[model samples]
Target: MFEILLALLAGIAAGALNAVGGGGTFVALPALVALGLTPVTANALSRIALVPGALAGAWVCRREIGPVGPTSMRELTAVSVVGGGVGAGLLLVLPASSFDAAAPWLLAFATVVLAFGRRVSQALSDRLGRSVALSSRALLTGQFFIAVYGGYFGGAVGVMMLALWGIGLGLDSAAGNPMRIAQLAAIFASATVLFLVASDALSAPLLLGAMLVGAVAGGYGGAHLARRLPAPLLRGVLLTTAVTTTVLYFLRG
Candidate 1:
């Protein structure tokens, strides 16, 4: 019962984080693993539980969803769906041990990116004397790879996307957030379908259900709340989550 409650709370925090800035997996994944699921199964189940919440957040921000410069949302979403499916397939085929070993380093890298991505983007833009914008094809290709990662592990993929778009197309994080949530939904939705059909993600029905419910509530409310937050505060919460989660993972190792 206690573990179940923990899962519920974790889901709420994760969903809220993703809605605001994207670091939900850092909470949701570790929470499941601590509950005794294997790393691969935890990853699969987290994706399953978080999809609806992502969509809820996306819906709240639907009016704010906008273009990524040259790349239309339609094209990016198509690539995300296909790439997410492929990445989910890979997770099922690969060894679980591999994922367990790689998890900490992946989280660390993502933490660093989430922490400094925007600043780095601005730095590069200043260095070049203009914001670098990718062609439509290039942008789509980059999104494909990120979506693939999103399906496979999905910690800070939204932040990564924001960083990429900010660097490549000079997109503002706040303005691009709605579309980020939407694309995250698309990626997780495709991945969830594959996991439901192919993986043991449904083994813990109660745990999944609890988290799912909590996430939906969190995502819906967080989206609206995020609109009122100052950008720096949002980034601070994201970074703090990332750092704390990364430290916990390393300690567990």
Candidate 2:
């Protein structure tokens, strides 16, 4: 009962974070690991549980979503699907110990990206002396790599996508965020399908179901609340979550 409640709270927080920014994996993945799931299974189950929230967020921002750059939505979606599938396959093949050993470093890297990705993007833009725009091929290629990473660990994949768009297209991250959320859903959706077929994500059905329910509620409410909450407050919450999760993973190491 206690673990179920913890998972529910983690899901709600994670869903809310995904709706507003992106760092939900940092919360959901670690929580499940602490509760005794293997790293690979935790990653797979987290993706499964968060799918509803991702889709809900995408729907809420549907009107705002658009092409990341010269790349068409169809093209990006294709790359995401292909890359996500490949990443999921890799997870199933890799030894569980590999994931355990790498988890802390991955979490730390993602936290840094979440905390400073915007500044890095801005610096790159200033260095270029103009808004950078990528060719369609370049955009798709970049997105494929990001999608692969999203499928593999997820953590701050959305933040990384926004950073890429901001740096490459000099687009405002805020303006591009809706599309990021949509693309995130696409990545997670593809990976979830693979996990459902190939992983033991269903072993803890109760935990998964609870988190899924909580995520749906959080995702919907968070999107609506985002409009009312101050941006600084949201950033603070996300940053704190990222930092705390990263530290915990390191301590576990």
Candidate 3:
């Protein structure tokens, strides 16, 4: 009962974070690992559990989502879906020990991005003296790789997407947020389908159920709350979570 309650709370935090800024994996993945799932299993289960949350967020932001730069929404989403499935396939094929070894480094890399990605995007934009939009090919290529990463680990994938748009098209993070959430839903949904069909994530029905229910509530509420929250405050809280989670992962190593 306590574990179920903990998973529920973690899911709420993770879902809210993903809706607002995209560090949910840092929360969800760790909580599952601590609950005795292997890192790879935890990753698969968390991704599966979070799909509804991502979808909820996307639904809430549907009206605000638009084409990103020169890329049509249809094209971008297609690429994301394909790339995410490919990545999830890799996860299932790879040895579980490999994921365990790589988990800490993945968390660290994601933390660095969560901390500095926006600043780096701004600095590059300033250096260019104008927004330098990527060709459609370039944008899709970048998104494919990010989606692959999202399917595999997905710590701060949404922030990575926003940073990509910010540098390439000079899109404001706020304006790009709806699209980020939508794409995240695309990535997670694809990954979840693959996971459900091939992985052992369904083995832990109780934990998954608790988290899924909590995430549904969190994602919907968080989407509404995001419009009213200060961006700086949200970012600060995400950064803190990212840092703390990353440090603990490293120490656990």
Best by lDDT: 3
What tens digits encode model 2's per-residue C-alpha lDDT throughout 70-174? 887888888988888777877888998888888899998998998898888899988985545788888888889999998988888988888888888888877
What would the per-residue lDDT of candidate 1 be over residues 1-253, giving only the tens digit for each residue?
9989998998898899999989999889989999999889999999999998999999999888877898888888999999898889888888888888999999999998888887897787667655457889888989999999998888889988987887788787778889999999999999999999999989999999989988998899889889898878988988988899899999999
Give the residue spans of candidate 1 off by over 4 A: none
lDDT of 3 by residue, 1-253 (tens): 9999989998898888999989999999999999999898899999988989989999999999999999999999999999899889889999999999999999999999998999999999888756467899999999999999998889899999998988888889999999999999999999999999999998899999999988888888889989999999999999999999889988987
Question: Could you tell which candidate, 1 or 2, scores higher by lDDT?
Answer: 1
Where is model 2 poorest over a 10-residue stretch in terms of lDDT? 128-137
Name the runs in model 2 displaced over 4 angstroms.
Answer: none
Evaluate all candidate structures by whole-model CA lDDT and list the values in order: 0.90, 0.87, 0.92
TM-score for candidate 2, please give it. 0.97
Q: For model 2, what is the alpha-carbon lDDT of residue 177?
A: 77
Worst 10 residues of 1 by lDDT: 124-133
